[model samples]
Target chain A: MTARDQVPDGAATVWQRAVRARERADREEQLADKHEAIATETRTELHFRMAYIHRTTAARHRVTADLLEAHAVRTAEWTRRGGPPPLFMTGVAEACDTASVAVTLIDADSNQLAAAASDEPARHAQDLEYALGEGPARDAVAALVPVAASGTALRARWPGYGPAIESLGIGRVVAVPLQVPGDCVGALAVFDPRSATTDITRFVWVADALTRSFILGRDAGDGLLGEIDHRPEVHQAAGMVSVQMGCHVSDALELVKARAFADSRTVGEVARDIVAGLLKLG
Target chain B: MTLQEQELAAVFAQLTGEAARDPLDTQALLAALVESSRRLFGARGAIVQYTPGGAAAIQTDGTDGALQALAADAVGWREGPGHDARTTGCALIDVDVATHPTQVRWPRWSPRVLALGHGRVTALPLFSKDGPAGSLVLFTAPGSLLDERALKLSRSLADIAGHTLSLQREVSESRVLAGQLEHALSSRVVVEQAKGILAARHELTLEAAFARLRRYARSRQRKVADVAREVIEGRIELPTD
Candidate 1:
């Protein structure tokens, strides 16, 4: 397919916008440095502080711009390769030196409300966690730290989850919690990473970059929110189950997870069935 | 607490809060500094003279025509307790304006202090990190020296003002940087979109299309982003060279 046919106008526009932003940010940052040098020469706190602020703001812009450039490059390359549809999470996967990774955003109760994965296997891995309600992403969020488990250790820590995930031929996994001041938003999960040394710091960096430059940045305006796998169907299924079983929404969600786990089906699949009136629970 | 004391507490709280935040609003903070110091010490009025900019902002508790004239005179004459303190990096107190040594030192402006019906004037240096950035002057009734407590409090307020001013400058500079980034990013997006359009239409590679876009932009002496916007909107076309 041609580049335009392969890449949607909106997607192209987003990446291009990001590139221009980065360029401008770089210029502004240099200007700030010049001012800072002058302030340093005079040794005035007020002038130095002003210059410092400008530099910091410019740095923020630079970061956003860098992210957009990466995104645009990834999109163009994917279009050229005639690959499967592009997802922003693909960038995180590439950054982590892995082909399979997922970025998941959790709600207040630590439920995965939105997710974007690099590939189907990665998506399935995350879906399994959401269905089982026990996984690296959930644990990382709960502990507010990075969690890495490979092979047998993964199964030992999460008896059901470890065995289920192993069935997917994933030998190792690592997750890092994404955090902002006073809030742990979610976690980034890397599965079967190509890099042998499980550098938890690398995972942390990806999470930080995503949280600051993409999720919280201006690029994540109204349009990008839709890109997140919001999984409204799951919430709808939970609502239906709640009404039928006379349980709280939370309990209904648990039931949905349990049914998915029992059937060895993805929570999304089970949720979809319930939403489609093909499944019942009491 | 008494009304005046309560007001002073609120003002200090606001100033302290602003200083702690990322962006310090210098103008608003300075105004508050004068207002709080004027009320706390019961001064007729207060004036802040910025060191670097030589700008003076005045805040008065009530209609004090004398204080206004005195502030104007200090700025115009470039001499007085405020100017002296800023220069010396030390506080200046003229308790008795009539026969004070300041009259001799500031022959032109010192006598005017007495004429303004000011019993006492105190100038506190607004010390920045390196040195005095400006001066905060308080005008009080004649024969009424700021008590030890009031003197200490006013000095602390001046210190706060200096810090706040620095922070405010930082915040404004950062905001300008953010605006620049947003503008650049939006422009870039337009350029990238145009490249995609070119690549798709001509069956050319993305790189080739971008190079063409750049080539066209350079030839026309225009921004690549502006050219890209034209291409995307079909307002212009690149030469097939």
Candidate 2:
């Protein structure tokens, strides 16, 4: 594993900050329309709230920064010894106090739009759900709560998804909905979490922070392409396959996903081939 | 609804409307609070003293120049019903100022307050979850005190003021956080653009490009953003691995 595959804290923070800026700009515009005295009072309250949010956000960032810095130090030492260091998302998984974690962003239809995982197994788990379209994430979104299942319960509830996940050696799973108001953008899925009870709370907080402060705020303006790993090529390939197979784009996408699952390859790889004209769907 | 209930509901709706319009406008909320307190209690005048960014006071109409001066002096001296309410985080009343025992407590402040021709004063603490935000003070006519109904109404208005301040504070904080987020986003965007350029130029994956950029930044004791900027500007080059 190489360090390149990690979504750095710097990038996440930047994206979060941008979303916050847009919110502030809207508030500032509203403030301008108010009376002078009201504006003055509003300004003070705004400062107070800003201080509170800054303190909380900074505290959270400090912990992540320390963790990332320590990993960087270890990587540097290893590099000096001529060895490649571990990937970055592994730190995110560890930060959540879990061995494997996958953050998936879905659209209104609960279809997986993008996903990032701590490791290959975690990625496979997400892919399995994405292909089958049923799992903890879907259930979490449906219920708007944290969904946890271990061992028999996991398999029993999910049926196909459960058996497949167990095959990946993930006996326990936790999924927390990332939602704000009426909108639910995605779920954070943790596999084989260290402590289900405590990790659930952490996952809930992470999900809430991501939904309230980062994702939903951006998604309000269709500003999600920056952080999500959007597969435009896949969409293009789906469109092409739809024309060739005399099917709808949705059906074409399903066919592509089914083929990828059957071949035991990543959807990205198969989509690339389709787009490159090396493979065609009939 | 009874006439009283209908009147109260209308007042509440108006306050809520003001809040919805500009929830962070503390001064307007305070002004409205003082006016409501004065109108509900039929007091000689109403003053709201709060430590927003700093100590401040706003008073409803009908207060003479002398009374306004006394209210300002009370805050300045830090020895009045408003000051006490803020310090104790409790409602305070100095009824019948001429003979009230607490009148002795404000040695310098009470005399001026009484000289303003106000007989009684009440201060209700405005609280935030963290601590006391400030106090709402009301002045009744000389030799008179707010009746049970009037006091209750005043308390209700003060509570609304507290809610307004709290709501405004939240809105203000969110805006500031958003501003900081914008700065962070722009810097990250530059770094990301640099990564894309490097990845395409070297026929490397995005991840490999990021690793190289970060590694170079660490070696030079610089931010990855700085290194990425240099790369994008073609001032620095990364050897293909």
Candidate 3:
């Protein structure tokens, strides 16, 4: 099916979501004003803190609303022009002042459950991480915090993945964990971002928006606008290798990654070859 | 700032402070609301009937047992000014419990309120984004009536409390939904991996392997995902026919 056809909701629904976000932002702003007024009258530290909290929440909602509005506009343009579907991550990348952004949704154990990217470089970066079993995204998810590295620092942090991604001409990388209360669901990574854009506050806001509004929102059933690639073949290969070698699937998954890294290929490519009986590993 | 303004600011700080607390304590919030409203309006007693996200609660500010029991019964009976305010999403102020009209309106509740020595009552609607979520009822001594200023202040307090409660509920629901989405995604990944293992082991197609997994899970009265996990974990071995 065409990518445009894969969108779970029409532009109308996206616009509605944008409007709802704007309304929430307005409410939060009003609350912030109330708290600020009270704080001024009482000169109470508690009121000031409450005001700050409301203002922060209001800013987050405004960012989400702006992102949704941009997505809706792009979707409408695509609808009129009859082109490839507009990806949700494109707006996210633009908001971060970068052309390459990837989101990796992970399980509790930090294994990638699915991934989406704004461009091929971002996708390939995620693939390299998957195959090598290390990268900024993985570190962010594991640490539940933002991670950033540039130049030789990337290589120092991840010997195998750092050089490989640097070879792609990506000079810098930044990743922030997508966190909900009491749980970390995933991470968002940006590659070769503009200089000094990795201050991470804006990135954190975008990540929070993605976690709350897009991934867990009411229309989330559409599965991230159908852009997420689950890499089913990789998991399937892990299963096949587990049975072939009579080992647990988790170990089989590690073996698959090792094979991919040794052969200098993506885990997806290696998985496809194994699934087709063109390659075997014991 | 004037003395009254300072007092109002203190009340605002208390309510907002409680609202902004992490992992909000609903009981503490209710207590704060009751105490602030009673103190601000010079009422003898105050009760808060809050129902945020389908959970109903009623709390009073350390009042006598007989009065608390009557308030609890008022919620159940749905015959008091609080019930009227909640149902209509409007305030009922300066209501005299000893008046004939009040007695007729709340035949079972008014006389009992009078017997408790409260002559006047004021009920304010606690509003959320989704409409009225509950009510705050104040009981005052005989011949006392709240002026416009007091009513406005009480309304502001109720509004803040309602908004805070609803926001807390929304945050909790979002957290739950996020967890479920994560669980479902991981489960699907596990099941797909299991299918591959089964297919490779039995030299069968992926679809056939899935059927075998489902059949085995059903026979054992287990979830397919659970069976898939066991397969992936190497805890369950399926025989080749």
Candidate 4:
């Protein structure tokens, strides 16, 4: 037979045509025999993927909630355990993380703002700018709106913060502006040095969520202040990166940023190793 | 042909008959096509190009110089054997590059085929979803002919390759979305953990504890997650603000 005559029609072949026909017939027969089982398998696979996505989403929410919940839980533990009242800076610094944790309030002038930062050298790395009267947080506060630093491939945009931030080993971070409508004032900055994906897409989702929380928690602000434990490991890592890299504390902080991301390990874990003398940076 | 060759031909016909229409599945399709073609046609090298982009187009199994040249040249045809692919055009399938008739029909590409380790070449244009994706070409010694069966088999395999590529693109895009979702959730959990540490130590409300932490981070020049780790570690303590 000529090839044209032998070849079947369309996206399937002649033999496939027969197989598909038979399969369809058998499927109809099986539907009559066991329809529920087939449906169940389909349902099960769909549920598996849906559950995975849901679990991932919830995990993100839970961490943010945990920060809020820490207040009550830690207070009881401290009171129950009964230690001398922890120092205020110690408590606040410890609570700060790459997640949504730090705060920014406009100072007396209302035009300029001051920052209360966490102990993360990466996060603290940027506070130097606000301390020096310039940075994303400072601009966000003056602008009186949510400001962001989507630090991507080209980060020289933040001029002063860029080179300084680079030394802290941070690849990318975002500082969102928080202000009430009709009352443009200081802002809150949460610095997250992410190394997971190419973009700050996830960080943006989280920062947005935290900003909402800030707006919602505004009335509850005065009542929310609490004591936090100091995060020695992070500072220690910053110190180590500084010592090893022979850079300032800020530069040392940046070293941890690159290391934490490159190894896919947390800055904390790497810091632990440094403290224990398990690994060293080149 | 011998009985073995005929039997092999029959198996190929059956597979192509099955996928004669659809190129999506047909598992074990491409390798089978190559093996069958090599045996049936006594060819030296063959390329199956599907989804051709002039510059950005991606090809599978066409790691050869000729195919790369075709992509770079952006020409439709050169001479006796090569295939020229464009975004939109009549799919060209030249089954014999060294043959006299094809050699005379195309002037430029003929010598290039001789330069490439093969004396003969045939190029086929594959049309998928009614669009010009790319072409498939078979190369061989002077004795080889672009037989009907070999051409049919390679064409079918090319279809399968195209389907696989489409699926891969879909999968990669989904991964990007999934990664973003994961990142969002992790950051939230960390923030919450820091809050717990702050509240417990300072004897304050959760929100207030967060504010204090934010305040300290602003003052200390650090990241929020970085600060939270410290609060949990006791390196930097929080004050009751």
Identify the leading candidate in terms of TM-score.
Answer: 3
DockQ: the better of candidates 1 and 3: 3
Which residue segments of model 1 deviate by more than 4 Å? A1-12, A24-66, A77-84, A221-224, B1-241
Best candidate according to lDDT: 3
Interface RMSD of 1: 16.5
In candidate 2, position A146 carries an lDDT of 90
Residue-level lDDT of model 3, residues A70-106, one tens digit each, is 8889888888887677888888898888999999988
**TM-score of decoy 2:** 0.50
In the range B1-241, model 2's lDDT, one tens digit per residue, is 4333344445555565565564345656666666666767778777767664443443322244665566677767888778788778899764566775766788887787677777788888886535677787788877674477667556655654665666565455554544444344434544655555555456565667789888888888999977866765557886665
Q: Pick the candidate with the highest DockQ.
A: 3
* Per-candidate clash tally: 9, 14, 0, 102
User: What is residue B110's positional error in candidate 3, in angstroms?
Assistant: 2.2
Q: With candidate 4 superimposed using the best TM-score fit, by how many Å does residue B223's alpha carbon deviate from the native? A: 6.7
- All models: lDDT? 0.68, 0.63, 0.81, 0.46
Provide the global lDDT of candidate 1 against the true structure: 0.68
Model 3: pairs clashing at backbone N, Cα or C within 3 Å:
none
* Per-model fnat list: 0.00, 0.00, 0.75, 0.00
- Every model's TM-score on chain B: 0.72, 0.72, 0.88, 0.53
iRMS of each prediction = 16.5, 12.4, 2.8, 19.6
Q: Which stretches of candidate 4 lie over 4 Å from their true place?
A: A1-282, B1-42, B48-86, B95-110, B117-120, B124-135, B140-144, B203-241
Better of 2 and 3 by DockQ: 3
